[model samples]
Target chain A: MSGTFIGMPAFSPPTLPAFSPPTLPAFPTAAKEAVRNPTLRRNLRYATHTIRAKRAAAVSELDDWAALREAGRQIKDHTLRHLDRYLLQLEESVTAAGGVVHWAADADEANRIVTGLVKATGESEVVKVKSMATQEIGLNEALAAEGIHAYETDLAELIVQLGRDRPSHILVPAIHRNRGEIRDIFTHEMSEWGRPAPEGLSDTPAELAEAARLHLREKFLRAKVGISGANFMVAETGTLAVFESEGNGRMCLTLPETLISVVGIEKLVPTWRDLEVFLQTLPRSSTAERMNPYTSMWTGTTDDDGPRTFHLVLLDNGRTDTLADRVGRQALRCIRCSACLNVCPVYERAGGHAYGSVYPGPIGAILSPQLRGTASDIDASLPYASSLCGACYEVCPVAIDIPEVLVHLRERVVEGGPAVRQGAKVTLRPARGHAAERAAMRAARWTFRHPGALRAGQRLASGTRRLVPRTLPGPGRAWSATRDLPKLPPEPFREWWRRTHRPGGQAPADRQEDQR
Target chain B: MSSRDVILGRVRRALADVPDDDTPYEVAVQRGYRRAHGERSIGETVDLLAENLADYRALVHRTDAARLPGLLARLLAGRGARSVLVPPGLPADWLAGELPTRVADDAELTPHQLDRVDSVITGCAVAIAETGTIVLDAGPDQGRRRITLVPDHHICVVRVPGQVVSSVPEALGRLDPARPLTWISGPSATSDIELDRVEGVHGPRTLEVVLTSED
Candidate 1:
């Protein structure tokens, strides 16, 4: 049975258009477009607020939530610190369990390895679970380039694929689309994929979910190869776990003859027991459920149960660069719960597409700049997307200090500094257009060093307080356009302090002393 | 160098700043979380399991060993299921009464064949009360993973007290890591459209969990 792929004949590849990654504008430009769409703003607002309230309630059910969050953080930290040791151990365990482990240094290498594996099986189509890692690497496009079709089986992913749209949210990829939009996508696009939507489909979520169930079932039953990405890979036991609400994850993981899982090296914990912490925190934080509907955990392979041939591709893809910075490395501790996205005020207004990556919201603001490097216009602008309200950090299950990383990335963008890219150490020049800000900062530093210049400047500013405009001219106009400038005090603090506390005058400190 | 060696070298280089006397894994993490939420007796735990399972839209049934077959018959008859998939290790007495056509889970049963079956009945390895989860380890009674998944209706029998745990941590202790385990909270559900959760997608739309105790 292992000689031939099981369940179905080798079908011809479907004729889908080749995917070319889109070049997106910077955060502010994209955000300006997003906020103007009233429909998008309302959709994001309702989804985020609803999930936010439910998540808070789910988390409050457990009194020891803080302890669980800390344990999750420390476990990830400890694993990442000694990652080489744990990865080697994991490789040994998986190999011992009759599975082949492959390592890919970058997205191109990972894609090449996966494509070759699928070609080896002689299968033109593969079923997929909803996986962030696979999306991050653009695996579907890579396979499509090789004449292999990758079918996304998750309900949200199905909507996104059918609509030919990019994923907007981590947990719910099609969060940007309302039920009416989704019904249209399914009704119009489902036939082109495999099965057509039922006649006269309605706009209710239940009917939409039912349509998705029927459309994906045909592909699942006949699938010969399955591809996925795991939530956690236990180093001690060589077990990979995928947490999902839909049954698509189970069908993709179980029915196929060959299963290939592309997982990030950082998605590992030291032992199986560590799952106790994340299992409690992830579901409640992500979907606001006590536990997701289905969580599948499998070690390499068994004789009579699931997939017969198991392959694990451990992907690096710029993770090593993200690990170099001590402060920024905390972003690796993310379990992808996406609680931060729901609570983010900026994400609510600008929406997920504005972030310009598969990961959006506050986590994306920090992670994209680090992993992709702050070289592109979007990557450099991502660091400034947040208001530093710190809501993301508060809702984080692993306690990733996203605000700290965002600020650190801002420093990386403004000042030329040392960074690692593709396993090579390279120094970077400050991003262009920041020269004015940099020069102003330098001049302020110089003036602060000399007390006479600072005092003279303060007096001059105080004397000409009436001359200050309500808004500044030139580049500062955009900064002050939406904000009202604070009024200048009648005199500087030093002058006021000197006048209020003269030797003959009754000082406030003396009055307090007298009262005492 | 091979890609494996290159990636490992990169990881080592990334950690060059780590001190030699760094805290080891044993002392690095603090695990102070509770094993279970609130304390409950075994019976109360099982009752909580029923309540929480129902909360997620799974049908919960309580019956003793003698009446289990009758309850199973009634459920199958109620659903008007023509064919029921049976695992190898399921007790014969559980289906002794007259029922639908039985399809045995075996090598001959393909995924497509399982798709046509109206329902699947099996015993679970362990059930968690706090999260309303039933874990299947592809055990003898549970059969292959595909049997419970492809069918539209699933009737999972859990032996109370012996198979029930209060929380996820406790459930993990009873499960083995080597086997492929599936933890099912309720039937398949999705909150994909506007974050409004709708149960029944791809998986068995009807998840009937029967808690049978041999008193």
Candidate 2:
């Protein structure tokens, strides 16, 4: 039965290139390169530290932050548990509100639906509002394939697109690029797109922002179609909300005649009232503001205001597969606040590029493996990308225990058990190249079963304590390179225990000596 | 099967682990968060709104119903706005005195035209004190969303202690979800560059909020 389902044309993975380029190296390899770049490290450090301090200050002002965080988590969990019912309700509500609803099972389907929608409108260009879902599906590239241009209107996204770079951070896609780099990108690349940067553009953020404003304003006024990814979709009212710091979102949302929004199915909240919790938590956790500069909420298409024609594409991609894991489903609770990214030590060092997915930092470590499955080298290595520091869990507004999920994913990688892939249940073989670790674990398990063998091994190790090298000879050298191998004692603990204590009830060593 | 059915089927199968007697929505989620953060008087709430709006670099002014027109005139002239977009339902008396070229918001007023207008004036549906947010619901007083968005300067009039709420939750209760809502906290700002915030981006670069009390 499963084979027949997989045989269907629609269920097959699309021929389009993967979201992350296949040539990208695994986490460790990429991270090694990223750490060597001093400029990248400095940029990540400066951005993360500034946001972290402000985030702390902003969160401190909310007295009921714990309650709000718990509520946000519970709401998301409840919504996911009964997502089917809410999705159907959402479809009904949206349709009744004069909007069209389309469902896409994966990225290809989503891109196709959006492309068809844009084509039907006779539009060759569309303005975008920094949507991660669209980025995840590589919608811009897909549209470009069809001879349509998708312009990224967000300042950070504009910089990334102009530089021909992949987004390295969630909130600020160009966080890896400093102001000087941004100025250079703008000065060089602005003309090809539409407007040229003013003569002698400086490196100040304000001036750069003004240049973007002047360049994008003409596009906004002329844009006939706008594509966006909603931050939250309310099932009860079919209301979609987008929270953004810049007015680019507003420009795209309001100026266009036709609006196409591709939203992940997991981005739903059960009721309109549930927004209060997220509205309070997301901004503080994300941009560390009491509220972002703008939040646009529309139930559907209105008669003479905003977009006259609205199309909502509900995208599953790998969300259903992600929801299948009892432990891993918590990743779906993410608000894409990127709070975890800002707080992650590993992310700060490795940078967002190493995660090799649209989502980076600790969240990506757990989410990428589940959504894409740990079949590839990058996916397999993603589980072990973290030190399990648990800072991502600490800053998560939804209270997703990221460390727990990372450890769980690590188990998945090593054990290779029953899992879902592209809506099919498949048994996974243990990831390749873990045979050595597996063998070592099996040997350790054997040694612990027999006390005599364990004692013999311990004695042999202690007898040769002086001869044990400072670092292991071959595979373990890398592990010990930056770490100090502990010095083994002259006597093992078992031998010391046997010599010092009586089997029967007796005070051990120092106490007995004191009594005597 | 349609992709909707396919996706929904997948969702049900994925959630097969959920027991038939799983907790319902009402009890499953605990909403213990406060309706409002701290207790404040109505006057104090309005004051916080003004303070916070200003904190984000929005220009805030206080006046009564009788003086509102004079204040609006002064504000537009001070900004040197050549033309102001007015929602059709905005109170005429508010702009009764000297004003810029009054551009009425109508279907013919395209986004490009709104861009040419120097400023826009509208009345808000609700004002959130904690976040310094003003919500527009395309009400009679508040025109189409684009009018406020396309122009660089926005002068919003808020009824003191009436439209103002202490928190987001309080504001939501008063808002209708069916209508489109645009919540403006401050003039457009961005923190994308090195996470350092700089004001005046795409939206209205200048937002002058007038708090009017009937008196």
Instruction: List, for all models, the DockQ compared with the true complex.
Output: 0.89, 0.87
Off by over 4 Å in 2: A1-21, A502-516, B22-24
Candidate 1 CAPRI classification by DockQ: high
Q: Tens-digit lDDT track for model 1 on A1-516?
A: 121343232453333332222466899999999999999999999999999999999999999999999999989988989999999999999998888999999989999999999999998889999888888888888898887788999998888887878888999988999989999999988876777899999999999888988888989988889999999999999999999988999999999999999999999998999998999999999999999999999999999778999999999988988988878889989899999999999999999888998889999998888888888888889999999999999999999999989988899899979999988999999988577788879999999999889988989987898999999787677778989998776667676666568777656664444323
Provide TM-scores for the models.
0.95, 0.95
Question: Could you tell me how far off, in angstroms, the CA of residue A433 lies in candidate 1 after the best superposition?
Answer: 2.5
* Regions more than 4 Å wrong, model 1: A1-22, A499-516, B21-26
Q: In model 2, how large is the Cα lDDT of residue A475?
A: 61
lDDT of 2 at A220: 91
Q: Per-prediction interface RMSD? A: 0.7, 0.7
lDDT of 2 by residue, B1-215 (tens): 99998999999999999886567677788889899988898889999999999989999999999999999999989989899999999998998879989999888777778789999999999999999999999999999999998889999999998899999999999999999999999999999899999998899999889999965
Report the C-alpha lDDT of model 2 over A1-516, residue by residue, as the tens digit: 022321112222222333564566889899999999999999999999999999999999998999999999989988998999999999999999988999999999999999999999998779999999999989988987887778899999988888888888999989999999999999987876777899999999999999999999988998999999999999999999999988999999988999999999999998988999999999999999999999999988998998999999999989999999999999999999999999999999999988899988898888888888888888899988888888889999999999999988888888899898878899999977676778778989999998899999989998998898998766666668878999777777777666668475344745445333
Alpha-carbon local distance difference test for all models: 0.90, 0.90
Give the Å error, residue A255, model 2: 0.9
Cα lDDT, model 2, residue B65: 93
